[model samples]
Target: MKIVPSSVQLLLERLRATYTAEEARLRLSRQAERAPERTLRSAREASSANISSLWRQLGAAGVEIAGVEQELADQRTLEQAERYSGNIEAMVGTVKLPVGVVGPLLVNGLNAKGLYYAPMATTEAALVASYARGAMVATRSGGVTTALLNEGVLRTPGFKFSGLIDAGLFVEWVARNADELKAAAEATTRHGKLIALEPIIDNDIVFLLCRYTTGDASGQNMVTIATDALCAKIEQDCPVKPLHWFIEANFSGDKKASYIGLITGRGRKVSASTVIPEALVEKHLHVSIDRMLAYGEMANLGALLSGQMGAQGHYANGLAAFYIATGQDAACVSESAVGFTRMERREDGLFVSVTLPNILVGSVGGGTGMPSQSAALSLLGLKGAGHGAALAEVTAALCLCGEISIMAAIAAGHFSSAHEKLARKR
Candidate 1:
């Protein structure tokens, strides 16, 4: 007789009771009250035990398992990809994302400069095509010039004092002892370096925005650990101890679409720009330069009226795709895509630029090491430490190209038609 090598959980559960010599009745203590112990025992004794009683119990309760049959088909191979430990509550197999490619885009940046392909994982049908069209235009018009605009990661540690006077005194003390505070913070991590400790006073609270230069990782956890270390040191040595203190006061603007993160820049920020001649715009984008410029103004006005944070055309589309393909923390897209896009006609042609103020990324951390995600990064040749900035510049250049194609597609009355053909074909 042969037993099926089944789901590890199902195997463990069945054998635990059988080998322990515990009767099925005693084992069903946490089980449903409806199924009598005798029936459970009979079900367990059945030769085809794995799919018998428990599944029947769940099925009787109006639950379905057919859809998971295919998902669990290759349980063994899927189990090997399980990279999580200690924090493991349960392991459900991976869901697949459809990854596509757009670009042979040209980017001129301080760290990365070349023609590159962008891998985009998205469900939207016309998304990759829109970006490809944008990249095509940029490539024809030379390339987009990119710059590393700013670099910093912040963790806001908040403190509460009895009165405003105490808060003011605390702020002064922090300012005076910045060197010592930095030393304490630096003790926690090898890669994170303490750069700035900015204090903000609100009533009786002191919000110290602890900023750091994180080398290769996204640095959220790095900065948080270091700041906690600094906060502990402050609690021990400061003359006026805070009435209450918390690790995060929400000022770091981790995921929020705040103006502070937009201006001060929470993570890697890069700007990509290009000047496309009027004739090239017409040939590739199928729109006149003057009309495109007019449309830019109109779009800007609409964004202002709608209270939108980012005025660019479809910044999220490219950023979200790139993030998914590169295995970034997807939630960062909320703040990462928030920026200003400006377009002005120059004597040469058109001046188009996009400033992505925050692109929280890492080459050595998070999900970047996962099998498929690692392949994606390696495909782009982005590897090792200090490559995070290079990724940001590439992403910004992709965004610039995407913006150009989309704005032009809309201006040339191709938006609906393009989507109708690519997005919803019968």
Candidate 2:
């Protein structure tokens, strides 16, 4: 006897068919063309004298420049400062941050393995030391296990139509011509690949959620340029013209925290877990396994009551410091900090794990080329290509260390005292 498929099963089959069809078309039309060259006018050398010249130019333009020149330009240095042209505009002196090391953190991950000394650049006192203590405990307990679950960067572009019929027709056309759009997007960058194009329709509006896998780089600007090219192609070819459209509809959750980022993820989705022996927890954290677990439950409740996106403690402390030290987009911490922390009881010990859905980090590109940031990445042995996943894994593990330490401190009733001793003066 033959059995009929259920509604859910049929829906799954249809979705699989749609994906396979798009993949087949992409494979067939994989030839990518080079993007058009765009250049900006070169700024003068990034030297103090050149800065003074610019200040003179600004002064001539009747802009008040004496204070800025005295404070920022006077403090500027010439050590490879010329390279700052691409990274900054209207050059001012760099603000120096004290960099601290938290490791020999042992990470057993798919990409990241062995011991690493993670560099954290921040002004916050006791942050690095707390992470260091947690790292020590984790290493003694056989290290943290990390996994890079998924990776995708999204860029959503919206379109306006006269009515629902036009919007539906546009969505159908986009779905049918996904391959061409993918090709156009891929043409803009050698490293970025257009992995998926999802159409979300609302009445007379259609939003195309363009997702890409950016190789080795965070791919923010990469996706934007590629999507621009794809939009241009759509405008030229699609028979149904949009009444209005935009390159980015602000639906991607770029630097802001949102429910969509928590659900679907924006960058690298990574998780780290470890089991700290009960004895180790008692010795190092001065807290019993049961106490830690109980505190975690209370913390989870407080997070929910406060409307937190994901229940966790101080994921931002490690993420922000790591991002700044390793040359990632620091603002991304707003979204990257959204994650879940789980603490459960095991026969052998207390099991602690952290799952971060949005970890926008890269081993190369952007600020990674800067002198201090590059050095920090080198310190962790995570510099250059083929290390983005490893870097992300390390980041997740680092966050786990922070979570463990904070939970232990709060549970043991030492959180305030430790901070007072480390951060305040008598």
Instruction: State every prediction's TM-score relative to the real structure.
Output: 0.83, 0.86
Candidate 1 lDDT, 1-426, residue by residue in tens: 547566876878878867665665577567576665543222222122333444455556566867663463235424443443211222333567799987688888898888788789999999999999888888888888999888889899899999999999999888889999999999998888999889999989999988898888887778989999999989998898798999999888888788888889989888889999898988888999888988999999999999998798888888888988987888888888898889999998988999988888888777787666778888777856768888888889989988998899888899999999998882
Per-residue alpha-carbon lDDT of model 2 for 332-405, expressed as tens digits? 99999999999999988999999998999999898898888999999999999999999999999999999999
Estimate every model's Cα lDDT from 0 to 1.
0.82, 0.90
Pairs of colliding residues, candidate 1: none
User: For every model in order, what is the number of clashing pairs?
Assistant: 0, 0
Candidate 2 residue 31 Cα shift, in angstroms, is 58
Whole-model lDDT, model 2: 0.90
Worst 10 residues of 2 by lDDT: 34-43
Off by over 4 Å in 2: 1-49, 55-76
By lDDT, who's the top model here?
2
Model 1 TM-score relative to the real fold: 0.83
